[model samples]
Target: MFKLLLLCLALLPAFAGAQEDSDWIEYRDAYRQMIWFEKYGKPKQFLQNHFRIRPRDKSVPTDGLRLTLNGKATHVALPLDALGRAVFPFSKAAYDDNAELAVNRKAGQLKSGAWVSIVTRPDGVYAAADLRTACDQLLAYLRYSGEAAGKSCAGVQFSYPKNDVSQVQFHAAGGAVTMLAPKEGPAFSGDAVTTFRVFVYRFAALPETGQVVTSSTPLAIAALLE
Candidate 1:
């Protein structure tokens, strides 16, 4: 009887740990994948990198989803933006601990990945010349990374949340605003979410005059390659 009781006491700590660190992926894995962007020597001043929590199940509610890094030496809460992304944190301490990226949601319902997007302006305005340059930059990186083979930078796509009726228009130097038509499309290329208000501003469709693109609140402005 005494031996059985001793065995149960030894197992108590292990059981408690399993429950505490539930629903987690190794933080070292995330660090290794995301560290590439930081080390890339390419010109990407107009771009930003984020860590995304992708819900495989479309029915999962992410309204109040929370993520954290769990480790003996590191504990940080990662806040998600409207697009389910957060500016990835670079923590050597977290890396050393081989921590866990755990979420409040149930396990096996979601996956995590990296996202690269065009940098947005606070005033929701981007210069025509700048947009072209940004698209070209993304194309170069994609090609270097062996993606979008034989494709060229065609335009830029603005995406907003379903609740936001946003607008994207080009403002000519002389003062004419041309509104880009809004259509229904997914925020990302694939994996659910096919109802965001999307607006595509193709360079070929409009004259590349000295202009600026204005927006209201775009969750993301993706580089359109074709």
Candidate 2:
């Protein structure tokens, strides 16, 4: 019995390590799924440009972009190019803000243009200016191309992980029911669609080395209007 107890104690570390690895793998897969959903789920025409910030790039800090729409301030960490311009193809959260009016108001008064600023925190590292231009471009794409119309609904769909995880929790800007289905198939089925809003969430894991790794593609949902 004593020998058996010692053997079990010796195996504890291995078991714990395996568990940790399993968790990290699950998290990474979820993250990848979230990104995939955000990217491929959209109509190809709607995604004319791609705007994203890589999680690993030190140059693109998480709090690089600040948007003051309506009267509230929203901080966004978005990807940038070598020219310091934000890439196109933003997520819904990037533009869906109550303070859009305030952002336009504070940026500048222009007939066909607006001003936006990107300033880093703590050290106050300024990255770019006239971010509103990029936003305007995105707005134009959404408006003229009808991309925005595709994302104005209410519902939630689950994107299952590759592993045998029992449950996965997703984050959303609004409160909605979590359904056990892929949102894309039903939303695009051409059944008297009423609403069109989509949300995306990623599962990630931070290793002890401080490296963030994604496991799965991002998951996205298009809520039916009703």
Query: Highest TM-score among the candidates is held by which one?
Result: 1
Off by over 4 Å in 1: 1-22, 173-175
Q: Return the TM-score for each candidate structure.
A: 0.84, 0.18
Candidate 1 residues 65-175, lDDT tens each? 877888897788999997778777788888888888877766666667666778888888788888889888777766655566687777888888776767778877777
- Candidate 2 C-alpha lDDT tens digits along 1-226: 0000000111111111122211111222222323432343333321222221122223323233321212134443334432122433233443443212111111111111111111212221111121122223333333433344433222222222223233333322243323222222211222122122222221111111111111232222211222
lDDT of each: 0.70, 0.24
Clashes of each: 0, 35
| RMSD in Å for all candidates | 11.9, 24.8
